[model samples]
Target chain A: MKGRKINPKRFEIGQLKIILLILPLVIFMGMPIIFIINHAFKPMEELFAFPPTFFVKNATLENFSKLIKFSDSSGIPLSRYLFNSLVVTVITVGLALLLTTMSAFALAKIKFKGRNALTHINQIAIMFVSTAVLIPRYLVICKLGLIDNLLAHILPLVAMPVALFLVKQFVEQVPDSLLEAAYMDGATDLDIYLKVIMPMIRPAVATAAILVFQQVWTNMETSSYFFSDDSMKTLTFYMNTLVNVNNTVAGQGMAAAASLIMFLPNLILFIILQNKVMNTMANSGIK
Target chain B: MAETTKMSRKDKKALKERMKHLKSGKLERRYARMGYIFMIPWFIGAAVFLAYPLGSSFWYALNNIRITPLGRIFSFVGQGNFTQILIQDPDFMIYLVDYLTSTIISTPIIVVFALIIAMMLNMKIKGKGFFRLIFFLPVIIVSGPILGMLTAEGAGSISAIDTQSLTSAISSVLPDIIAKPISDVFNNMITTLWYSGVQILIFLSGLQKIDKSMYEAAKIDGGSAWECFWKITLPNLKSMILLNTIYTIVFISNNSENPIIVLIEESMFSGTKEKGYGYASAMAWLYSVVVLILVGLFALLLATRKDQYEKQVKRAIKARKKEARNKKKIERRNRRNAKKIERQRAAGKITTHTTDRSDY
Candidate 1:
């Protein structure tokens, strides 16, 4: 794959064309994120300027300080919401990954009755629009007396079928002969799964984790539906409240700041795990 | 390598046989038991979470149910909710049409954009990782009220362009149908780009899987880049395209801005609709069917060739005919054996009474 550089026939467009194509696209894509950061720092005048400026004219810490005060007024410290969100997201991602890997290994490597049924269920679940399941899921949460608890958010989504779907596809690419060889070497199925299959599909695991984390982190619907407690509220919920409720002094800027704060974890995860994610084994077994 | 070679082919065959046999007896049950053990968590999760909810929703869609302070009330009205959604609510039908049309138009656009970007990024280049990060960052950052605030009016419209004038100009010159969708495209350009983030990643991963030699061979054969792309790249991207299409459809259909979804939401719990739960459930179910149909249509349109269809038909026919032939052969063999046994019994040549069943 790396051999083509010697010939230098990369078949790329001219430099100007490449620049033209990439530059505007990169700008358009980055503008919202850039604007979010700019909005965070912009003064009140700049933040509310007509049509919105592309950059902050007079950068200030006033909005951030105001945001700190806003959290103070709410009585539940900002750290409480932040801590709850952090704990929920971390546990959700870990549990989701562990459970998904187990089910995926069973579906992909082990043969037993009901496996076909499970596979079909996952396929159907992928097509499932979330809205259809929303009311019932909420009702189920209510019935289980799990409302306002963090588990309500974590439990419903941790066994998501998409993670299972992707992992199963990747695991199928694992050679049956390799499995047999491991068996002949006196490895139990669990040992082979953990030591062999897991390492082999790290890229897939990372991909699933990234996706699962993104879903849990950015989810705006769940906390609202399930938790009404101020104490149980997440950073996202707090931000939602800040954006909608506060049309007062330095409101927009603080919302932007809160958005940035909320976005930081995703940004960090993506930046750190970017390479592993792009090497996803989702398409490895495609015909 | 020499040690492996020293294990003769016969020994290898024997080993395989033993392994095959080893799967039975105590080991088979052990693996099956372990499989079920591993499956326990998922089974519990599915039963409690997925299956129950999905089944209950389907049930709710069929009946009029209300929530009161005391307890829930259920009054079964078979297909009444569906009928009301389909017949009485002509307004819903319009939104449904609008939703389906927009999804049909936008799904292809997003998938194609993702593919083009994927193809471009697949070329080895400097700062490729940086570019990938830039493209995907929006997907992470842009969501919830922040995303809403950005796309909302006045303070932070995503684009600074005079969209009103641009859309008006486009509408003035072109027919309304063409103008509306075109302007919609221009208006949603930024939003669409945001939506395409994960899709680009998915497509790039898929593009990475194609053998570099395929492109090299095509180039060696004097194929232009365009030709090589259409032949090699697009065909290989077929599955990923299907995946992205499904993802985009499901994603957009559930967007908060979707009128149908918004309407359903209002009816369900918030509003004073008489049969809120049932009607909303009905609307959701109908909407899901539409989304599914659109996905199916994309899958059909993007399917590679009719040749595979014909091959499937031929295989089915051959299997049916072969089964009949095998059945006929078995019947003839059974009849012949029965006749020989009867003749032997009639001739009294068998001293022992076999009872016509050859246990020996």
Candidate 2:
């Protein structure tokens, strides 16, 4: 039987057919990414070349140096925005992970009053576009006196409905018998949650972490809306201003460089945690 | 043996019920308390961030609000803001129509593209991870400003495709209203495809979860690949398709690049007295309702339709059950008539006689 069996993973001549079909589409899909990198490296002449070049003939770091020079001339240095973004993203990701996992555990495993209702609310929350909540969210932030406060950035983004939904679905997959076994050993709920549940849902936690990080990292809304002070502004907001302030032929290079800088962290994080993200997606389909 | 097994099963159920009773009040209460303790942060967060804002936003939509250095001033305007947005606002209606048409056209394209890519990736191929990495790259890098910059530099569409000719051809064949969005889709084709990054992964994961033996069985039965896909794969993927569709719609609606969102943001900051917090809230409400309706429409379209085979089987079963019921009814009526005739004959009100062919 073993001798006659076909190996599923072995490469076959037939596989070439699929590769041929997919290769062109993959290249087509990958063009923008390639363009982004190339555009960032293009020298001034190539950047503005008529019949825009897809690939850079002359690669240069002039844009990066010029961007640094421009930011240095401004009142707040580039480091300030970078520092603010890093701090906010780290804090928000940490808090959101804790909130989401805890709430998910309660909603999924615990048979309690209002659990169903809370779950339903989270589901409904997923349907709401952020724009729908923008006005009231601003008003709430104002009433809470979070204007210009770093907490404003952290608060509105912490309770992510989609993250909760994903995490809850994951937590539900933790077997009841395992939890009961822990309970029989006189383990407290916190002990079970921290020891038993957390270990099982590591992929979900990682996924949620990446999600919150990306959101807080790229978010300019919080800075543009809440922060009046230039020093407190995030890198994304700063980048936006950097490009818009110099919206000209010369500014195009700086804009390209800034986009690359902004896009790099998300790309790196995803590359590192891509496996866990795939795992989370496997469980993400609406049942 | 069956009797013994049945008795044991009953006994087991009784024992389970007794255990449940024994563990009822105190233990259940303790778990409930623990659950609430676990949910405390979310409760606070939801109240401050979700419920409170939702309530206040609805209230804000109904009134005219001005933000002054001193404080916020509010005047009751009832449905005036909604009416103004619906009737009086020129840009709102135009942008809304454009948004609706574009979303309706682009969503199916994105989902189908994602599905095709997902299917290809699922096959036994070399460099699967590399392809997946490239495919999923967009989800991470895509942001409002970055997308804006990319599109500005004409990186949003393929350099090879002659969008000008394509758009002209589309416009020549189609009406102005319909052609505009189709042309826009072609012009920004790459960005539209980029929107399907997460969707591709979603489909890939779902496809993986399907039992491979089902495909094997179909193959053994001499089914073609196309037949297997339509009969087996498509039916199994119904829920995932709906999920991806809804996700695509919501993502498109809320995207910062979306004109309606940008319009709302502008109106909220506008210095004009007629526009501010109240007007933006009204617009947000209206936009959200439209998004909800779109989601509902897609959900109804994908979810409510039963599979053709399943529907036929259900109808067959119903017909069979109706035939059985009719047979039972006719037997009962014949039995009642026979009993009536026998009673009458015994009581001397009638006599039973052998019938000829004419009587039949």
Model 1 lDDT, full chain set: 0.77
CA deviation > 4 Å runs, candidate 1: A1-19, A175-187, A278-287, B1-35, B152-179, B211-232, B271-273, B303-360
Docking class of 2: acceptable
TM-score of each: 0.79, 0.79
Error of 1 at B321 (Å): 8.8
Lowest lDDT 10-mer window, candidate 2 chain A? A278-287
lDDT of 2 by residue, A1-287 (tens): 11111124677898999999989878877866787888899999998888777899989999999999998988888898888888889888898999999999999998899989988777667766576577678878888998988899889988988788767756776668888888999999999999888866766676667667877887777888777977888898989887888899889899999988988887787777656534432322123
Misplaced by over 4 Å in model 2 are A1-12, A73-77, A101-111, A129-132, A142-149, A166-209, A248-250, A278-287, B1-38, B140-142, B146-180, B211-224, B227-232, B305-360
Interface-residue RMSD per candidate? 4.6, 3.9
Model 2 lDDT per residue over B1-360, tens place: 676466777787887778886856887899899999999998889878887777688898898889899988899999999999999998988998898999999999999999999888877787777787788777666655556656777877877899889889998999999999999988888889998887786676567546677889999999999999998888877777886898789888888778889898888888789999888988888888898888889888999899788899999999999999999999999999999988998898996576889976
Q: Give the least accurate 10-residue stretch of model 2 chain B, judged by summed lDDT.
A: B140-149
Chain A TM per candidate, in order of listing: 0.86, 0.87
